[model samples]
Target: MILLKLFWSFFQIGMFSIGGGMAAMPLIQNQVVNLHHWLTLTEFTDLITIAEMTPGPIAINSATFVGIRIAGIPGAIVATIGCIFPSCVIVSLLAWIYFKFKELTVVQGILSGLRPTIVALIASAGLSIFILAVWGEDGFSTNPLTINLVSVLLFTVAIFILRKWKPNPIYVMLGSGIIGGAIYLLI
Candidate 1:
């Protein structure tokens, strides 16, 4: 029963997450963190960090990780499949329709409308993660010290590096990891 619930949860994520894996983060968070209570917001944030570092789409990686946590290897496999199944079906249908109606103005307009919605979804997901990372457990932390100043500083530095040098993300991630580790050890 838990396996079925896990599969269904991811299936909903896959079906509605129209933009991309990052866009799916909000839905995934809602299900895993809000509805299911399988993982704490902090753990979900950590999972996002780890998912970004690993290969594959964030949605698939997260599904596998959450599934494994809940029900082991079989859960992971089922969750991965659930996350992908909707995209597989939707993309195939869309491809066929797109080729057939590639010249239609309605289709063009629909695609244009979708672009902004996708951006909104991705932005919303980013904002939620940002809040979680900065504030820890409580959204409104009374103690200023509880706020993760290091994370905010690292985020700022990462943005600066990206804007200035445009280095590969892998280097930024590695640098951040080392810096974060060093800071933690020192403190």
Candidate 2:
């Protein structure tokens, strides 16, 4: 029953979460954190971080992580399969349709229409992550004491490095982790 529930949850995430992994973050958070109570908000944020740092899609990685946490290896397998199943079917069908209707005005218009929606979804997810990182669980308190200064500093430095040096993201992530670890150790 637990396996079934996990499968269904991820299957829904896969089916409806258009615009890729970043866009899927909210839905994944909803399912795991809000709906199923599988993980806390902090854990969900950590999951996003790990998912971003790892290879492959974030949704699939999240499914596997949640599944394993909930019900071991079998849960992981089922959740992974569930998360992948919709994409496999939908992509195949869409590919065939897209090739056949490559010149259709409606198809082109629909594709164009989706661009802004996708951007909005990505932005929303990014904002959620930013808020969580900078504010912790208290969530955007105006009080100065509530803010996570270390996270803010890390975020600022990361943005600057990304804008200025344009280093590989993996390097930036590693540097941030090292800095965070060193800071925590010192304190």
Candidate 3:
């Protein structure tokens, strides 16, 4: 029954998450954090970080992580399969339909319309993460004492480094990890 629930949960995520991994964050958060109570909000944010650092799509990584946490290896396999199955079917069908209707203005218009929606989804996910990182669990407090100085500093420095040097993202991640670790340990 747990396995069935896991599969159904991820299947819904895969089916509706049209834009990609970033756009899927809210849906994944809803299923795993809000609906199933598999992980807390902080854990969900950590999951997103881990998922981004790893090799595959965020949705698949999230499914596997939540499944293993809840029901071990078998849960991971079932959840992963569930997450992938919809994308496999949808992409295949869409590919055929797209090629057949490649010349239609309606198809072009539909594709154009989706661009803004996808951007909005990605922005919403990014803003949620930023708020969580800077403001703790209480969320969006205007009190100065409630803010995490370390997180704000790290975020600012990261943006500066990225904008100024445009170094490899791996280096930025590594540097941030090392700095964050050192600061947290000292504090």
lDDT of 2 by residue, 45-84 (tens): 9999888888889999999999999999999999999999
Candidate 1 displacement at residue 23 in angstroms: 0.4
Candidate 1 segments exceeding 4 Å error: 140-144
Screening candidate 1 with a backbone cut-off below 3 angstroms (N, C-alpha, C), the clashing residue pairs are none
- Candidate 3 lDDT (Cα, whole model)? 0.93
lDDT for 179 (candidate 1): 98
Cα lDDT listed for each candidate: 0.93, 0.93, 0.93
Off by over 4 Å in 3: none
Candidate 1 local distance difference test against the native: 0.93
Pairing residues by index, what is the TM-score of model 1?
Answer: 0.95
lDDT tens readout by residue for model 3, 74-176: 9999999999999999999999999999899999999999999999989989999999999986789989999999999999999999999999988998999
**TM-scores for all predictions:** 0.95, 0.97, 0.98
